[model samples]
Target: MILRSLFLSTVAAMAPLMAPVSSFAAEPQLKVELSPSSPKQGESMTVIIDPPGNLPPSDASQLTVSFTKSGAALAENYPAFPLDAEGDRYRAIIPTSPLDSHGRTLLQVSDTIETRNLAVWVQKRNFPTQRITLRGSGSGGATQYELDRVAVFKDLVTPIKYWNGIFRAPNSGRVSTIFGVRRYYNGVFANDYYHRGIDYAAGYGSPVVAPAAGKIALIDYEKNGFRVHGNTVGIDHGQGVVSILMHLNSIPTTLKEGDLVQAGQQVGTVGSTGASTGPHLHWGLYVHSVAIDPVPWRNQSVD
Candidate 1:
């Protein structure tokens, strides 16, 4: 009788431990859906997660999402949600990197509640550029030209918060010239000129949209006395993410300095203005004056 009683006590002690393990083994029921599985570089997509009805509405911040791409940089906003009173919706913006080409990509989203994965393919485009000779017709013009180039570089270091978001594409087109591409202007071995912006090859009058909502910071007509950039607009998207649209045919009537805008809103049209030789758009993205390539943001999965 004494031995039997001792065995019963030992069994009771181990039962509690096994009960917890079995409870954890039960996977929580959940579901995830992504909109527009395939998108061009510099685009935004939505991700929705449906949990079991028994689970109460939870904060999205507790969840995590990430992306991985071969030969491409992944840029995205993380844990973005909770700004509204209505809970259960989370949003993020993804930007593809310049090195990314036509190929497969991956996105992974997980949390204590559930895990989900997705794969996507990127489209390819060929961006072309040609060299042309620029000559000074006036005998004294060469010296003036040298001085002008110096002045522009001097002001390049002035840091400014022009826009917000991780970074976004100014428009859609095959990337022609990437940021940091060396250039030789007039055989002078122009200063390791990195293409500060991503060039898009498109027809004239192609609609150029604002990458993110922000206020117009500057609109100028003349940069080098030749009406360079023709009509240009800069929007400060907050947090130092600035978007500059150059070679614009015309600015929208509703847009002006200090005017508010939303992401994907039409701000101007493409044109062969200023220093451009053909009809295209020069979309520049700046982070506090540091120029970054916009190619990577395309087709990025938002966190």
Candidate 2:
């Protein structure tokens, strides 16, 4: 109760700071709204920023939006862009990390002339883990790129919140492969390439749920040699947070781009569709564009 009160106070204080850009002044009026306003700490939220009026296209590049939790430094890729076009009405999918705890999140929207800000309180939720296997193929020489991606993610960001909400066990079994574990394919050393996501060892046909609320951004199933993230579903949680669910048996044909979803919603099922050794779910989280550890946020406490 105390935490909730403090959260509310912080949001109230931030409201006035987010003023509309006055017409007399040459600034875009900024307004922000969080879909499903109250969300669990590890869950995801869509941040929509609306510009006051039509402005010349020449100044469009000057507009910017950002989000940050009180004590943590904002990630470089924050205020991420959608897979589609870019314009005055900017949208980003923001995911709250487990480390976020109880605090106010500030969303700043600005143009060349003026800036506006909004504050939001993130609630807490319960997340549990289920075991599953992840299988994928990679080019013989791509080991370096894969490993570096993992290293950079772990070193840069602190895993404090579960931006993708709670993950359900993809299958009823043990984790065949843990996150951050070193791997060696065939007889070569996969140095620096710690696994970036968790692999639950589940049989085929296991249900895969949306880690959090988001819009379906991209779906790819082409055969690209050594580029192992096969048959993937990428969900954009506003404010630059994205969830990638890989190696699916089949993506629901009904699912299409720009589809809004809720936590625990079914998106796909586990399968050995692409570059795979077995059937499982390769779940990953990205802040803005930077990949981060998904485990910490999986089962975390807000207070």
lDDT by residue for model 2 (98-121), tens: 445556667666766567766666
What is the per-residue lDDT of model 1 for residues 237-289, given as tens digits with 9 covering 90 to 100? 64345667888877787677777877788888888777677878887765434
Q: What local lDDT score does residue 95 receive in model 1, on the 0 to 100 scale?
A: 43
User: In model 2, where do residues sit more than 4 Å from their true spots?
Assistant: 1-173, 184-192, 223-227, 301-303
Clash count in backbone of candidate 1: 18
Among all windows of 10 consecutive residues in model 2, the one with the lowest summed lDDT is 153-162
Per-residue error for 9 in candidate 1, Å, reads: 54
Task: For each candidate, give its TM-score against the true structure.
Answer: 0.47, 0.47
